[model samples]
Structures are given as C-alpha cells and as structure tokens.
Target: MRFTEHEMTVAVDTVARRLHAATRPPWRRGDAVAAYDGLERMKKWRLKVTAGEVVLPVLTALPERPTVGAKPEFTEAELTAAAQTAGRDVMEHRKPGAWDAMPAKRRDRVLATAVELTRVAVDGMPVRQDPDALIVPDHL
Candidate 1:
C-alpha cells in the first residue's frame, strides 16, 4: 500500500521494534547477527526514505527463518496467511485506492518482508532470563 513518508517510517519502526525484541536473546548466534544486520539495513532505508531517495524502503531479500529444533507452533502456510492478513489489515486502514496505486513488485516485496519478519519473530526461542545479559557482538 502507498503510504506517506511518515507513515512508512512509523510502520518500519514498529516492525523493527518487534524484530529487535523477538531477537534480543537470539536462539543462535547466527540469528542474532542476521537480525542485527537486517536492523542496520532498515535503519539505512529509513534514512533514505526520509531523504526522498527511495519511494518505498522494502528490503530486496527476505529475512532468513530460524531453524527450530522443536515442533513449530504454526505451519508455514498458516504463517504466510497470517502475514498476508496482517498486511491487509494495515492497508485497509489507509485511504482507498492507495494500495492499488502501488506497483505490483513493491506490494509483493513489502508483503514478503512482512511475512519473513513475522516468521522470524514467531520462531525465536522464548527467553526466560533477562535478555540484556546476552550481548551480541557488533562486528557480527
């Protein structure tokens, strides 16, 4: 859906916060590193969007889903459907025709990113202890 720059920023920030919280005490080192990298990229995109360098700051590549040893709570199809519903809910709140105005590629990219992010968030292991104790190295 087409969004104002401010709206997009808010949406990005919302998703970023969700991801950061979910990945704070990452299930694995690699997951933490990937989450950090994705957050960094999102930060850069936010800047570019604010500067008008990019109309939509959708990620070109989807975030990698974490591998869980235990049985997943949701199936892949369920997650995909949930993500699409979430995306649609967000779009439905916007002005009519705005979503349709966005190009198909942009819409698909946005949905893909959303779905990947949701999957990553949901797949993260539950942390019982304080997440702040674990420090992910910046270099990673």
Candidate 2:
C-alpha cells in the first residue's frame, strides 16, 4: 500500500496515459478535457503528498525516510473520511459493470489491497518503489 515518490509518479503517468488512450478518437472533446483536468488535480495531490504537506492514506513512508517527520495524527473520523473519499473516487472512474463482472475472490483481494494501502497511508510507513508492484490485474 505504501508507495515511494517514484511509484506515485509512475502511477500518475500510467493513469494519465490510460485515460488519454481511453478518451481518444470517437470520445467527445469535453470528456477528454475533463479527464485532463482530473489528472491535473491528481498531480497536485501527488505533489502535496510528496512534500509531506498532506498525508495520503494510501501511501506510507518513502524509501529514503523510514520514519516520517511530525505529521499531525489523523483522527478516526479523518481516516474514515479519507478512505471514503478514495473509494468514491475509484468507484466514480470504474467502468460500468466492471465491479459486478469481477469474480468474488478477485473482488475480495482488491478490497483487501485497498484496505492495506489505506492503512499504510494513514500510518505513514515506509514502502518500496517498484513500478511493477501495481495491484491491478492484467486482465482488467
């Protein structure tokens, strides 16, 4: 769940590329623009996460810094809110019928990964930066 700055950067880039590819050709111009804007917002969020100004509940510590500086502890309500926000964002972007199409086992694994990522992000724990360590399945 915890990811390095490099990992986050890769993720942002991958998402951007994927979104662009998805919105190409027959896709409406407005849809592409909206996707671009959303990606821009995500980039800003990634910057905040990198600067230690905002702690993302999906990432823990960076490789170089095993321990984080004095970040304010998030309350239970704050943690819940953050997790909920993450879930909603993911759900909003998911392809229609995709969730229902997944096998139950796969769905459970995905949910577990989400929980782990959220926990590490909230705890500010250190994590590796392997680009290939993405949780997304190839079939998806």
Candidate 3:
C-alpha cells in the first residue's frame, strides 16, 4: 500500500512507543516488543521485495488515525491523564528530532526504489498471475 507520510509517521511512532514500554523492566516479560519488532522487520522486507502494487500487511498492524468530527471517546480527565502518560513516554524514550531528519518524501522515494529493485529481481523469477503476490508473506 502507498502510505501517506502522516500514516507512516503515526505507525512508526506508535510502534516505537510500544517498544519503549515493553523494554522497561516491569514490562519486559510481555510480547509487545517482539511483536512490534517483527512487524517493523516485516515491513522493511516487504518494502524491499514488492513492486508497483505494494500491499503491506501493516493495514491492521497499527491503530488508525482518529477521525475528525467524531464524538469524543474520553472524558476530559481521562484525556488529560492519557496525554500526561504519552508525554512522559515521549520525553524519555523517543529519539529527539528523528522525524525532522527524515522527510517523508525521502522515505517514500527510498521505498519506491526498493520496489523498483524488486521488479527487476522478479523479472527473472517464474512468471505468476501477480508478481507482487509472491512477495507477500503467507503468514502476514
């Protein structure tokens, strides 16, 4: 799938947050870090081996962006608490200025190049009804 910059950023950050949480001493027994790490690796591999139509399995890997104009799900108190938790997470674990260093266009371009390289690689493989389909892992 062709992900927008916002979508990819949200996904990456979300995963990073979960990773951070899981790595803490109290949460180390849980599976969140392993799952997110696997997903991140899978995305990189899929991006490396698909062309033209890059349908990533990450469609369900991360939460969707909250819709605008939707009824609020949390009371003001709950929202405030949640924000405080997230802010703490960000302040300590998130790499400072990582987002600024990677422009969305550059990331997309890199993905595009990977797809192009996959197309070249697939040319020599046995023809299939859908060349890209071969790249999608059966286990998603």
Predicted model with the maximum TM-score: 1
Expressed as tens digits, the lDDT of each residue in 24-103 for candidate 1 is 77455655445646666767465434322112222212223333334235555665555556555546666656667778
Measured on C-alpha atoms, candidate 1 has an lDDT of 0.48
What count of clashes does model 3 give?
1
Q: Where does the lowest 10-residue lDDT sum fall in candidate 1?
A: 53-62
lDDT of 2 by residue, 96-132 (tens): 5565666778766655544444444434432343445
User: Which tens-of-lDDT digit does each residue in 8-120 have in candidate 3?
Assistant: 44444443443344445764565654654656666544433332222123222223334332311333343333333333344335676553465668745544443333323
Higher-TM-score candidate among 1 and 3? 1
Taking every candidate in turn, the Cα RMSD to the unseen true structure, in Å, is 13.5, 15.7, 18.9
Model 3 misplacement above 4 A: 27-140
Alpha-carbon error at 21 in model 2, in Å?
30
Could you tell me the TM-score of candidate 2?
0.30
Instruction: State which candidate, 2 or 3, has the greater lDDT.
Output: 2
For each candidate, give its TM-score against the true structure.
0.40, 0.30, 0.22
